[model samples]
Target: MEFFEKLKALSYRARLTIVLHTVFTLAETIGGVFFNLYLWRLTSSLALIAQYQFFFWLAMMLGFILIGYAFKNKGMSQLFRIGFWLNFIFFCLIVWLGERSINWTVYLGLLSGLAAGFYWSAHEVMVLSGTSDKTREMFYGVLMSGESVARIAGPALSAGLIWLGAKWRGEALFGYYLLFAFVALLFLVTELAINRVKDVSFERFSLRGVFGLYQRKAWRWNLWRSFVDGLMISRWFVWGVLSYLILTSEVWLGTMMSLVGVLAIISNILIGQWFKPNLRARLNSWGAALLVIAGIAYPLLLNPLGLVFDQILGEIIGIPLFTFAWLAWFYLAVETDYDGKKRQFEYYAGHEIWQGIGRILSIGLFWLLASNLEQVNLARWWFGGLSLLFIVQWWLLKKVRTALVKAGYKEE
Candidate 1:
């Protein structure tokens, strides 16, 4: 309908790039989840899973560190081109490891992380460059919608593939590995096509030169914001919770994850077309409100259901219940007001910092308390704390939103 027309009018290059990158993201999701599951099956240890996660984050952190600097000095498309090849190589390497029967779950996880690090930092940098403040929110929402769609399909398809692989190859792990290899090839081909796009730049790089971007106050602030935001939700909290949940229940986890992905897709559509275009501030406020509600309800409701069902509910709707709201707010924030060349880089750096902090805090405090306390006691404690956390996070978001609004970041 009119929605497609509006999207087409936004920017042809932006739409094409988003669609192309979405294809890559879809493959990565499918390959990534299955690879992690394959490793889990091989090790059958939560500790191993945790180790895998640790290396994954470490690799990603390193990638971001390097790319953050490069993004400051070099061009966006240049970064994109480099990221594609790096990711493609690592994907092939992972497949090679699988072929050798080197089922070192920890190393495999690290490898995946390393590959992803290059792909993500570059991808974000490039995509963010394609839009400006007036359209950035809608742009991010659309981009995320593509990712959400991929996530929805990835887990469901993975589960089915796992089942089929076991039946056909007589070894489920082998089947998973085969699927991963295929996806990697798909990535390689896509990257090749993307690079061939006329006018895509491939500029030179230098670590020392990137520091010049910091001289611009706008860019500096953007980086700070991104780092803080990234820290809050980055690999830390998500990975820790995921590892814990996987140890508790894998099958249910995959199913519920896909369900969440489906919800995210719906949310993305609403965000991109309706919320982003019309009510940026309202979306921010609503997202905070949802968090406030869910934070209180989750622990209270989950305990009685027992761990497995509780996990399913949490995965499917409980965790994401507040997250979508938070994300809606952040995407809008990024899309507005900030005028800078290396916006995503700066924002991501700051976001990564906060994400790291949040992860550390959650892992240290939330995980500790959740792990040690009696289930009933923990449930009671978390119910109250979750509510409090939601309120506090909402307050913080409100402050940020207010500040941004004061700075004149309103919808057109």
Candidate 2:
């Protein structure tokens, strides 16, 4: 029975794709953190770093939209291929400009944003097709675990490379470029490997048929519920991530990010292994509630701590930092069984839109209100208010969960 079961599992397309995807994720994860660190180092301005984040998020939003239409039109594979190579080229460009100057760093940020735009959209769509919702959430957890591992491994490796470069008369940014090159190499290799996998026919990959599920009233309500859950939470996460960048230094940023990554990985593992699929929806609701609290507290927290200590805590808490935990939760929520294709897209779109809104509002708030407040005042009052918001967020999540039950959702 064990032999037969192993054989059966080996025949699954998703399992194969997950393996290939993991390889791609590991490289990108390392390359991406190093890239961000280098960019922050060059500019040392939180606003500029936030601008880079804005562009990256904006690109993903637009890319997902286009990928949706493209999937509907049967051009999914072509666009994804474009994404793979575009990422390759983008990393290569970063490698070519490893002098660590301000202008080059700005250029790197733009290119990285462009690359992320391509990579995230295509990668997400591809992953969606590769697994059903039954396994997709678990699959996502696995993939994230790979990334979290990379988070720890990438920085450690980059730190080593930086040391080597220092000894060899090479610039520190060269270490970043080296990591980029290695990651780009992984993308190309994976692209080649994916070509060998059996191609998914557009007919079997149905946008219309899948979307028809959304026509059901139950699914529609569930989707809307999921969307609200995402919107309420993501606003604070993005705001906090950028705000922290303003205060954190490049040298320690990767280590801090890695700690957050570790927390996310742990979360993903717990969800995939212990949480039942039905219960996962409620868990997402709870997670979003936590995010709202974290969101409100993070800025206040950043305000009070000097950049150094803030950096220390950011690593320890891992919630509102520059890690992927927020998006991971948002995706898990949207991909719940109660949601249909329409809701999935809506959830994705809503998450991005809310993040964008949060970024804009937070920036304004900081500049208008918090910027003038002394660190002590900001810490005491701002964090206090944030803590209250978290409590509110928790209440809101419970209310949403109850509403889901009232709407006849057996799981959520």
TM-score of each: 0.71, 0.66
RMSD of each: 5.6, 6.5
lDDT of 2 by residue, 1-412 (tens): 5323432443245565556556656666566545555655565443444445454545554555555545543444455566677777777776765543345544554555555555554455455556653455556556656666766666666666665665576666656666677778877876665553454422222345335545544344434444434333323333333543554533455555566567756765555544454554455545545544444555555543433343333332323221232233334444544543334544444434444454444434543453345433443444335434444444444454454456554542
lDDT of 1 by residue, 1-412 (tens): 8567666666755776687668867777766555555554665333444455556656666666666655555545555556566666656776677634334645665566666666666555555555555565566567777777877777666666666777888977755766666676776777666643433322333333334444434334434444444333322233323443434543455565577677766666665666443454465555555544544454454432433444333433334433444444454455553443325455554455445444444334543454455433443454435445544555555555655566565645
Q: Lowest-scoring 10 consecutive residues by lDDT in candidate 2?
A: 316-325
Best by lDDT: 1
- Please state the error at residue 269 of candidate 1 in Å: 1.6
The segments of candidate 2 whose C-alpha lies over 4 angstroms from its true place after superposition are: 1-13, 99-111, 126-137, 196-198, 201-267, 281-408
lDDT of each: 0.54, 0.50
